[model samples]
Target: MAGDPPTTPSSTQTGVPNNGNNPSPSEDPNNGNSPSSTDFASLPSATATGDINSTDKGLDGGAVAGVAVGCLIAGLIIGAIVMWLVFRAKGSRYTRRRRRSEDRGRLMHSTRDANLVALESSRKPMKLENFILQPAPDKEIISDLSRLDDIIRQHVETVYHFEPVDVKVTALAHSLTAIGYSERLSGLQVEDVATWCLQTETRCGALRHVLSHVLFSSIDWNSPGALTLLPQPAIGFLNSIRPIGEYRNNFDVMSFAWTRWRTLSALFLHPSPQERTPLEVSEDDIQGQVETLAKALDPVLRYFVAPDEESQHQQHDHLRVMIMETAKLGYTLFSHTSDWKFIYRDDSGKRCPVLCIGLEKLCGSDGYRLVSPQRIVEPRVMS
Candidate 1:
């Protein structure tokens, strides 16, 4: 300690002299670099703001890191929501398609059931209005009428035999002469074939006998032979003609009914002979049809009798009864046509017969037509 020199800072700080012969000052051990008694203190307290600037810079770095992390998490959340919505839309579309498929299946099954019932009803010919149609959903059940016409034609051919044609044609001529029947032909009054045959008075063959009863001549009919045969036959023949209903509107049926329409029509144009009879037809053939239908229906209709009062107004309604009754016993209206003659016993026990024939004058553009039980009434023309 005695050899140690005095610290240099004491001299410089204190500006004290180190008298070589004098002793060291810490010699007193009282001072370090704490301060010199005569010097002022140097201090960093004036620049304390630099520490604040460094702290603010560190806080800004932490805030930026926090914002970047929050943005990344928010983006992940939005992305999840968008994916969920897309999946939801796909699921909804699937459900809608499945529901539609089920509905179509149900509709198909119901349609099949309705179709079956309609088809069965048509086969039985049930009341057309009541049957619900699924397949052929036509407004009118009667729209397809060709089938009905075919059925009626088949029935006619089945019933009428052809053998009676000649007898009917022969009988028609006799009744014509007995009655004064005339036709206006070529604008000149030409007597009909029937009239021509009967009044001829010339002792001649069968065909020529019809010719003499031409124009308007008195036919002296005898009580026996040809004249005698004309009466009941006349009634039968007259009953054969009937009024048919117009199921379809033909331009001709559309034309109002006028008297002796065909004869008047002939005046406008020289009608083809085919117009008088059907094409591919001879007088012999159509006359055959008349006799065939007449003979066949006579027995068939006669055999089908009416029910008693016990079952009065049963299955056959009054409408049907009137129609059928007229068909069977309604002879009072039947004595006018030329096909047969009518004979009746007036209470005098004598057979006084009146003669009538089919008036070519009354038949319309169509020739004589017959009505059957099941036939629909439409004015039937030769065509």
Candidate 2:
């Protein structure tokens, strides 16, 4: 090769350009046909890759955090709802229990109120008996006596005077004489006479008052004094009037009296000794005696006494024996008076026999023995 071209150094040996001062095509900066030093495939593009990875990581983290927070919020809501439901259920149960307890308490109170004790069986029976024997207040006695006088006056004017003026005068004189003679024979003071008159009038007035209001207008024709006449809410009230054993008898007595006295006046209707024939004098006297005996007995007997030998005869004998004994003592029997403590006293001290009986049956010794009205407790029901 040296002989052929006395040659210059090859480019590979000197690591320089074959042409002096000229760069090879691969190393020339201006060379368009040669490879450049920048290798896009081998050198990593760290800036762009790092930026993209950081952004993706940030997005993923945000998504995870959002999911966690959302789950936590959902769980909290569910827990709150469950707790609310549990508390509500507990509250409802507690309310039910409270209501049941209240109802039981009310029922017990009502039962206690309805159970009555007999006055005769009380611990202080003797005291109660003495109290019962005491006469009613003077104000009430005077009012009742005045009323009886008015009724007698009306009867004389309306019925006795219808026949003849002379008969009317005779009838008036006989009535006055009978009352006056009875008072004198009994050796009664003016107050005592007035009291006796009041007792008689009150006994008769009670029946008349009941008949005037209940029998004439309020009675059911098919079933007199039936409980159906009361309101539905008052069924319990009706049951509270008498004990289970005595309700029927008492109710029947009331009904019978109401009906019987509806057509009759409360005043006594009898023939005077002057009006009677000589043959009828003994019978008239006996009848007057019987009338006085009947008035002395318990007023309840007038309605409840049976006509059989077991009741009416025995009652009659007892009254007859009592009258005879009273006569033997020289204490005239006709003008005698007895106190009826079975009657109730209102705020004004007026006697209300029916109300007294009702209260005695309903409230027992608690109300009957006390001077005040009984207090009752009512039940509370949940809506």
Candidate 3:
């Protein structure tokens, strides 16, 4: 021990003695031999298998995300297609509903028109004797006469196809005759009679203008049969009337006769002459003529009923119907003159007013008063 280098125990000598089964330090588990083999096994291979596994996992995640995105897009496309189909279906249904509504409205209107024609055809003419009477008060008699006149007008309009210009003229003529009879019996100067005549003359002049314009414009003057049909009353009437540019006095005798002739000829020539195709009038045109004629007639009718309590109510109702009809036809009520005032006392005894032809007012205590014609009282004479 003294001579030897301090023999620190060799790792093999210091340790407990190794059994035969136990290996030396060079082969021990703690030595580099087994540990190197274990570490070599534990460490990653040159092939980098963990990195390959990580790359595979990343690829799998990307595929799943792509599938999710694709599903979302496909769902959106499907939803859009469904919405489009739904809206298109709704539009078609709405269109069909609108078409049905329009068709139903047209059918309803046609049915109503046909019913009106049937009713009008079945109605009888009104008798004038029921309303007009002699030896009555001026107010009562005028009211009755107005009612009779309106009934007659309505009857004529219903029965006749053409404008009832003659009917108004005839009614006016009867009223003039009645007034003349009243004047002789009562010795009362009903100045309203002269006013009525003047107004009627003005209306007749306007009606003549309208008729002449329509007839002349529509007639085929150059047709082969135009000259030969001299016996036809329409042609004769047109020839009798004054030309467009020439000035004629109101209430011309020829114009009155032509009005009557035109009415009769229209009645006789229902459906119109086949050769007179150019003169074929539309229903709208005829309706316009009727509306104009009604406008001319309204003032006269209002004048007669303006003084009566009972007839005023009836007049108002009739006027309302006329107004509604005129509105439907797109026409305005016009008067020949504007100075006359139709006055009626209200529930509060206040006067309601409407315009007429002269400054003459239809208001009085007895519901009857004389209306002076504008021409009758000269300004110089009055001054």
Leading candidate by TM-score? 3
Preferred candidate (lDDT higher): 1 or 2: 2
Stretches of model 1 off by over 4 angstroms after superposition: 1-66, 86-90, 93-97, 117-383
Write model 1 residue lDDT over 8-29, tens digit each, in one string.
Answer: 6655457577776554565443
Each prediction's total of clashing residue pairs, residues at least 3 apart in sequence or on different chains, is 20, 0, 2
Question: Whole-model lDDT for model 2 versus the true structure?
Answer: 0.35
lDDT of 3 by residue, 308-330 (tens): 56556665555445333322211
Candidate 3 ranges beyond 4 A from true positions: 1-38, 60-73, 119-383
- In model 3, the clashing pairs are 339-358, 340-358
Highest-lDDT candidate: 3
**lDDT-best of 1 and 3:** 3
Itemize residue pairs with steric clashes in candidate 2: none
lDDT of 2 by residue, 1-383 (tens): 55795778776667664674776656777877665667545346867788888887765777889999999999999999999999999999999999999999998876554432223333543222222112223344344333433442332222211111122324332432333222222222334322322343342333222212221111122212321221222233334554333547565444333222211111112133223211111233344543553453334233324446666666556544433322221111011122112111232222222211111112222112233433331111111
Off by over 4 Å in 2: 1-44, 59-77, 80-82, 85-104, 107-111, 114-383
Instruction: Provide TM-scores for the models.
Output: 0.23, 0.23, 0.26
Error of 2 at 71 (Å): 0.5
Listed per candidate, the RMSD to the true structure in angstroms reads: 23.7, 23.0, 24.0
User: RMSD to the native, candidate 2?
Assistant: 23.0
